[model samples]
Target: MKPDYELLVRGNNLRLKDDFLGMSNVTLIQGPSGPILFDTGGYISRLGLLKALDARGLKPADIPLVFLSHLHFDHAHNVDLFAHAEFLVSRREWDYVGAPHPDDLLVPWGIREQLSKSRVTLIEGEGQIDRGIGFFPAPGHTPGCFAIELDTERGTTVIAGDAIKYAKEAILRRCDMAFDEIEVGTATIRNILDRADRIMPGHFPELVRLPDGNFVWDEAAPFELMVR
Candidate 1:
């Protein structure tokens, strides 16, 4: 069966007035087996996700799997909330997240502890997670960052977690401020644009499609202003 998915915009672009530097969107994918979530948003976002699920008549326990695009605080800070779900992440990303870093304290250690007990699935290559949902390594934004390609009834939707934060950024080849490696990030952005028919960025408003075989912004505006 084809998976049903919904992109939940968890955080805002302007995180704190002057910081136009975060892309924190959580994707909820309901498959034949069970529900799966992509990215957990920031620490404060856990309650918001629970409340949103509650309003929709769903519960956190309903989610059996959770995938992280990367280990950045803005993307996976609330991972500890899904205690019952199996966590999926790229092997490279897992190594990066698990590596000894002085800044690790910034993220809740509880989350890491929970992860240790939870069933963690480390993806190593491009493959299908389900009939129509697939994952492929798109390193650069982070060593282990991966992108998802979902073949939906509407079209093929690519959930680009920070590989291409904004549609315009993908078009112009602009890298995010927090990228660990700029060259790798740019290459990943290009790879995404090459394969995606519809692009749903991490913190952007909604999906944008290349309807006429050309990059189109969500508001039908020019790429520059749309990203700005």
Candidate 2:
């Protein structure tokens, strides 16, 4: 049977001068084995993340697995919430974070120490995370970034984290914040676009690829923000 997915917290790409409001997507996947929490949102979305799980009749402790796309602060900061789940992060990422490039401010200073306290399974190369869910290296945005490929009733779906940050990156085949060579990042984007029937981008609404090789938002309206 195919797996089912839901975007627990929609990612937002907002900027204010030199600051970026990093609200990365948090997703829940009901795979054949059990429910998997993909990419725990950061401190900014902590409360909402808890509420989202509660709405689905789940608590952080109820999650059995947590798949981190990478260790960027916006995406991995909330791992502590799921104290009982086994985290799956890339081995390359684990090693790279030890001495990440000085300019890669996204890698929180003490994240490695935090992760060491948890039960983490360092993934290597392409492999299956669970029934119907396969993962492969999708480097460039980060040296060890990985993306999920799942078989759904519709077809093949890719949960492309920062490897394909948004629709623009997929469409234009470029990255705005690449840690690797720009060509490598663009190449990764091209591969994902070619392979996925639908893409869950890191900071954009889900996209459905058309037969004519174009993509459109998947029935959901763009994210909205409200200020009082």
Candidate 3:
């Protein structure tokens, strides 16, 4: 069994009009080796993210590892703040952003530049970030987007990036835009649903909790999912 761990969520909707102003979620996983940050939010969320960390008796400099779901600015802008952390990013994403097409608005220029910081480990297909925590590709939202697998007291949880931005998007099997093909995005979503009982989505105000416990979304909408 995995040791006792804490998963704290820092989620909110971006009210700004210029960007893809909507729900964004970041997760703080505290385990044996200090704290781990998953997808620190966009350029505008720095203040709130910092404040949230402070509330938990943590400062950005205290973080030692960061797991980036993708290179989207909305999900990866405040990386520099985690002063002592080593970032684990998908090698596919690292290379793609090294020279991305200017047309894909899903990827902005600034966030890609942020990868210049050292100590970044390029994770290939699948690997472990720590004990009972692993990662694998769940692409389509971006050429190299991936999801995190965490073993928790409640069971297994998947931190699916924008691959399944919201539960609504996953339920509908649809996407508004992405770096690659739409079909690929839907497939990635299905894969996550197949593997995890709970999900930490990239842009959802609440987690996509399955099997209905004391989860936040158990009442907002009636939905059904069959697992084989």
Q: Against the unseen true structure, what C-alpha lDDT does each candidate score?
A: 0.72, 0.87, 0.72
Question: Which candidate has the highest TM-score of all?
Answer: 2
Task: Name the regions of candidate 3 deviating beyond 4 angstroms.
Answer: 1-9, 12-19, 110-113, 208-216, 219-228
Per-model root-mean-square deviation over C-alphas = 5.0, 1.4, 7.1
Two-way lDDT contest, 1 vs 3, winner:
3
The reply for model 2, stretches above 4 Å from the true place, is: 219-228
Question: Considering TM-score, where higher is better, how would the candidates rank from best to worst?
Answer: 2, 1, 3
TM-score of each: 0.83, 0.96, 0.83
Predicted candidate 1 versus true structure: per-residue lDDT over 1-228, tens digit per residue: 676677554444654574434547788877667777888888656677888778878787878888888777788877667778888888887777666345334334445566777788889989877778899887766678888888877677788887777656765876664435778788877777777777767766555555565666554311222354
Could you tell me how far off, in angstroms, the CA of residue 46 lies in candidate 2 after the best superposition? Answer: 0.4
Tell how far residue 222 is off in model 2, in angstroms.
Answer: 5.1
Task: Give the count of colliding residue pairs in each prediction.
Answer: 0, 0, 0
Between candidates 2 and 3, the one scoring higher on lDDT is 2
In model 3, the clashing pairs are none
| Winner by lDDT between candidate 2 and candidate 1 | 2
Q: How accurate locally is residue 112 in candidate 1, as Cα lDDT from 0 to 100? A: 59
Residue-by-residue lDDT tens digits, candidate 2, 1-228:
789899999887776799887588899999999999889988988998999999999999889999999999999998889867899999998888888877788897788778778899999999998889999989889888999999999789999988988878877778777876677888889899899999998888898989998878855535566999
